[model samples]
Target: MTQQTFIITGAFLGMLAIILGAFGAHALKKLLSVEQLKSFETGVKYQMYHAIVLLLLGFNYTFSTSTMYWCFTIGILLFSFSIYGLVISDAKGKKLKVLGPITPIGGLLFVIGWANIIINAL
Candidate 1:
């Protein structure tokens, strides 16, 4: 993706993180257990962190790469979104077991994304 695309995606993800964080704090608080709420918050935090990184990469083209962009983008989707799914569904009494595995795969992507930066710097 281009720098513009990264910027836009980052903005969108950041915006969504805020919205979800609010929703989790307000609406979900009553519906979820303490552990579930904590897990949801973790997703929001990771999403926001990567969203900021994406914005940085977008602004500084020298630091941006296709692999890095894809890794973060897809990682957020898989990791954060999976946690959201797991927590929400578990709250509703039917947790999706499949998403459990997907979360780590997403985390692996995040690790790879960061590793890419370190490797490129060296």
Candidate 2:
């Protein structure tokens, strides 16, 4: 996707993160245990962090949008979505295994994107 489109999506993601944070602090805390609340907060934290990263990637025109944007997108989807699935997996009474593995892969993508930034700086 184009940088502009990625940025717009990042804006939406940022909004979602804020909403999720509020939800976590209020509704989720009441409904979930302390550990689950922490888990949920983790989701919001990663989502918010990568949301900013995506927004920066979108705004930085000198960077290759395709690489940075795609990495950010995939990182958000995998890292955030996995936590969502793990947290709510009881809704369907199913256990998810891939989430643990995939979350780190998403983290690795973030690392790579930052590595690229370092390379550009050099």
Candidate 3:
């Protein structure tokens, strides 16, 4: 993706993270348990973290960014979205067993992304 696309995506994801965090804090608190809320917060945290990373990647174009961008994008989708799904489903007494493994894979992608950046830097 282009730099502009990465920036826009980052901004959009950041907005989403803020909205979701607020929704969890205000609306979901009444319905979700403490553990579920924590899970949701984890999703929000990682989303925001990667969103900032993406924004940085967009702003600084010195190193390779495509791999990092894709990694962040896919990682956020898999990790955050899966957690959201898991927490939401669990709150409703449903379990998404399949998504359990996907979160770590997303995390691995994030690690790979960061590692790639460091490697490129050196």
Candidate 4:
């Protein structure tokens, strides 16, 4: 993807994180248990964190690459969205067990993304 794509995706993801965070803090607070809420917050936090990284990479071409871009982009989708699915579904009384495994896979992508950054820096 081009730099603009990364920036736009990052901005969009950041916007979503804010919206989801507020939703969890208010609407979900009454619906989800403490553990569930915390899990949801973790998703929001990781989404926002990587979103900012994406934006930074977009602006600074020196450190950006297609591999890194895809790693973070796909990572955010898998990691954050999976957690959201699991938490919300569980709260509604139908836990999606399949999503439980997906969270870690997403996390693995995140680790790979970070590793890519380190390897590129070296």
Q: Which has the higher lDDT value, candidate number 1 or candidate number 2? A: 1
Which has the higher lDDT value, candidate number 2 or candidate number 4? Answer: 4
Candidate 2 regions off by >4 Å?
90-94
TM-score of each: 0.98, 0.84, 0.96, 0.97
| Model 3 lowest lDDT segment of ten | 57-66
Clashes of each: 0, 0, 0, 0
Model 1, 1-122: lDDT tens digits are 79998899999999999999999999999999999999999999999999999999899878789999999999999999999999999999999999999999999999999999898788
Which structure among the candidates has the greatest TM-score?
A: 1
CA lDDT, every model vs. true structure:
0.97, 0.78, 0.92, 0.92
Which candidate gets the maximum lDDT versus the true structure? 1
Runs off by more than 4 Å, candidate 1: none
Task: Give the winner by lDDT: 1 or 4.
Answer: 1
RMSD in Å for all candidates:
0.6, 2.1, 0.9, 0.8
lDDT by residue for model 4 (1-122), tens? 78898899899999999999999999999999999999999999999999999999889867888888888888899999999999999999999989888888888988888898899899
Query: Local error of candidate 3 at 113, Å?
Result: 0.8
Residues 4-114 of candidate 2 have per-residue lDDT tens digits of 877887898899999988977886666666776788789889889888888887787667556777777788888887877777663335648767798888888878777
lDDT of 3 by residue, 6-93 (tens): 8999999999999999999999999899989999999999999999999988888666478999999999999999999999888888
Query: Which structure is stronger by lDDT: 2 or 3?
Result: 3
Instruction: After the best TM-score superposition of candidate 4, give how far the Cα of residue 70 lies from its true spot, in angstroms.
Output: 1.0
